[model samples]
Target: MSETSALSATGATESRLVGVTAALATVCIWAGWLIATRYAMTSSFTAVDIGLMRFVVPFVLLAPIWIRKGIWPKGLSVTNGILMIVGSGAFYTLMVASALEFVPASHVGILLPGVMAVWAVLIAMLLFGERPGKVRIVGYAAVVVGVASLVALKPAGVISDDMLMGYGLVSAGAFMWACYTHAMRQSGLGALEAASFVGFWSFVVMAIIALFTGTTIGDAPMGDIMMLLTAQGLLAGCVAVITYGLAVRHIGSTGASAFGAMTPALTALGGVILLGEPGNLALVLAVVLVILGVMTASGVFRRARI
Candidate 1:
């Protein structure tokens, strides 16, 4: 290869390396956050309380920067700001947290990302005129089927019927999150700016709610409060969003999201090993279908072939 070509190849390799590393980090944080959210839900804290802890610290920490940058991001549209609130802000937090009381984190890991990926493609088609290839459509179909089977089928008694509500809520949350992903992609904002946008607006929504309904923060145990503060507030709320934004920077939004196909495996294992949650062949198969489908829908193999 010519010297210039070699230099170009080296730059591409480094960029991919950085993107992959960031994507991997985002996946780990997402999995841990699922596990931690599940643990909190099973304990004394309500989902609302979890939401409070999740955004409180992030809001406070990012406040100084956001105050200077102003409330709305410089170039972000009003529509995207609204969609983002539904996606990563108050609505997103409450939906996922509420589901955790009934849904296993393993199921969450598999289902939410799968559904979100499908929604992303659908939204892209509707809003941007983007079309998925046949293979990608097939992958989307697999994700839908996997989600259905996971929710409706329970031959081995792996999933509880009571969890149906949880599954429904998660599917809805995935749609909202997909909207958030697209908004983030179009916003032309950096990682920190995106984090601040979601954090500030979401905090406004939640603060309004707390005023009317009151808060459970004072009633919860200090240890649990502190634990969730670190888990939901710092790591999941601020750090994960920022890190995933970095992945978006390096790899493009679509590629960064494909890394979410890894989430089910991580959270499923984390649930089984760390939390002693039950797992069986049925759950395993469902997770496989979801992962494989998302990978294909993401054009991961197609791009690799090129």
Candidate 2:
């Protein structure tokens, strides 16, 4: 091969490696966000408090950038800002936090990312006329079956009415996230631009809500509060968002999104280990199905010619 061709091959390989590494790290931090939020719920932190912390820390950290670039940024549209803020910002945060109040972290881990993959695919198909192969069809079916399996376990004294409500809320959050992802793809905002827009708007909106509701952080221990702030704001909110963007830029959105398949099992495991949440047959089965379904829907196996 020519020296230039060899150099190109090496660069492409390095980029893929970076994408895979970033994607995996993003998933791990996201899982930790779930676990930490669950812990916060049992403490003095309210859903509003947790939601506020998520944006406040990131917003403060990114303030200089806003000052330099201005709040709106040059390329990002108003619609992009609105969609991203509502989809992944305060709205999504509060939904997940409220759900944690009613259900285990394990449920959030499975339902949120699992349903998101399914929704992203369906949305693509509907809007773009993308045809699903046989493998993808089966994958979509598996996701449905996995979710239904969780619902089925409800009558066996496993899932409660409150849990069902939590599931509904989380699912809605996932749907909003799917919309956000789609909007971001078309928004022409770079990763930092999108993250900054989301952080700023989320902080403003949550602050307003907190003022109206008289929501305060209460007497939650400073250590616990700091943990929540760092995890939700810095790690999951900022770092994960940037890393996922890197993955998308490096390996394409399809490859980056396929990494979501690992999130369910990892989050479930984190819940069991960190939160002492019980792991059962149904949860395990759901995790397996979700991982398989997401992998299939994302075309991981198909691309491998498996």
Candidate 3:
């Protein structure tokens, strides 16, 4: 095994509080990123354009570290290398960016966390045999109902090809992310190394996609494009990616997955302040319900493991 794996094995039992805090930090960063991403997506910019920059910023930031580490982890098998960089990084980015094209940032905020939490619970139960208790199951139900209401109430003339596609894509991204988290744990790769590997390959795949699709430059408002690229590439890429990778390493896959539930609430709040998206009554109620459900599900309400 690699040194990263060995270190993980020795430190597995070090501290649960630390792990949980790390996961929480990741969620906060992601929530803030969601707001910025929504603002970045306008009639002027397409998802592909945003995605290209996501890869570019990270690749540039990691250039030195990558050079020093010699590009690619020593212990990463070829299959995992491809899966992490391509499957986890590039593919997920494609799904999310495309979805954001049609879906409201609020909808994304609600759905992203719901999908992630539910998937985490299911995957943990099936793959790792970890079962959430009764409270958590009920909490999961609240999340489902809350998300369903948002969809059911989607404005009547507003549903379009783009919106439907966006939802599907984002949901797929969530599922892929869940699988990636589990796979990383199973593979025993350390967080930093995994992040670096994913960054390298994501950059490669995105570049290929940009080339194939013919990257859209000077197509959107130059100012918006610049802002989007900087946020997605630097804040979301360098900071968020590195933080999340470290979080997943400290928290087990299941616990880390729980943090996703907060993304929607944070995003919704962001929408109100940043995007001028209305804070409807439904938004407030949904946020309350989701927050309570997440708390209950995380076993804070009861001593049961979720």
Candidate 4:
């Protein structure tokens, strides 16, 4: 090949590598967030308090971005803005925050990847007449089966009334996330714009709730407090969101969501390593199935257009 052609190929390969690295980093960020959120829950923080902290950290970290873009949205409507805010902001945080108190974040880390994908696909089909191909259908089925194994058919001793309720709530939270993701995609907001708006509105609502409830805010040991806030703001909030937004731009929502399926297994591993949680072989297998099923459903195996 000519030098020009060689240079072109080299650039393209670099870009692809960058995308993969960024995507993987996003997954790791998510996994760490789950673990930290679980630890933070053990403190005096209520669900809303954690939610508030999550946003507060990110809000401060991203203040420059907001300042550059300004607080006000240029062309957003009241209705769409509200939907975006409620869907992505308060409800999403509330569900996940309360969930960490009850269920292992590893469970959530695993459950959400496929759950969100299946929710988005099914909702779109039912609401908009979009249909999954045969591969996608089987993939979706695998996800359902895997999820059942993970949540419903765990060892008999593991199931309890409270655990079941927590599972149900987290599943509902995942559904809300699916709604939020789909709505934001359909809302015609630029990715960065939507992310900034989400941060802003989540901050607004979380602040309101925190003030109204008089919930204690970040009163833990200063190190723990700083660590949680830093994780929330830097890793989970700013970095993960930006990477996820960019991944969706490069790979589209379904593909990015599919790649996200690996997070649960990673989260489980992290929990085992960091939190000293027992790793069950059966749970590991189930999480693997969920991740595989999501990848299959996402059609990432198909060749990308040049």
lDDT of 4: 0.75
TM-score, one value per model = 0.89, 0.90, 0.78, 0.90
State the lDDT at 277 in candidate 2: 86
The pairs that clash in candidate 3 are 99-166, 109-264
- lDDT score at residue 168, model 2, on the 0-100 scale: 89
Where model 3 places Cα greater than 4 Å from the true spot, the runs are 1-28, 68-71, 155-162, 219-222, 242-260, 302-306
lDDT for model 3 = 0.71
Q: What TM-score does candidate 4 get on C-alpha atoms? A: 0.90
Residues 1-306, model 2: lDDT tens digits: 999999999999999999999999989998999999998886678889998889998798888777778877777777766778888999989988998988788878888987887788788989889888888889988988887777654546576778889888888888889889888888887777778878888899999999987665766677887898889999987898789988888988778778867888988999998898888788889999988898887788877784
User: Which stretches of candidate 4 lie above 4 Å from their native place?
Assistant: 61-72, 151-154, 246-255, 304-306
Overall lDDT per candidate, in order of appearance: 0.85, 0.85, 0.71, 0.75
- Compose the digit string of candidate 1's lDDT tens values, residues 1-306: 999999999998999888889899889999988999999999887777887888888789988868988888677789887887789889999999888888889888888899898899989999899988899999999988777766434565466666888988888999999999898777887667777777888887888888887887898889988889998889887788777877888897678867878899999999989888878776788888998899899887777788
lDDT per residue as tens, model 3, 119-173: 8789899977998878789998887777666654456525677777887887888
Consecutive 10-residue window with the lowest summed lDDT within model 3: 297-306
**118-164: candidate 4 lDDT, tens digit per residue:** 88897899988998999888888888887777644456647777667
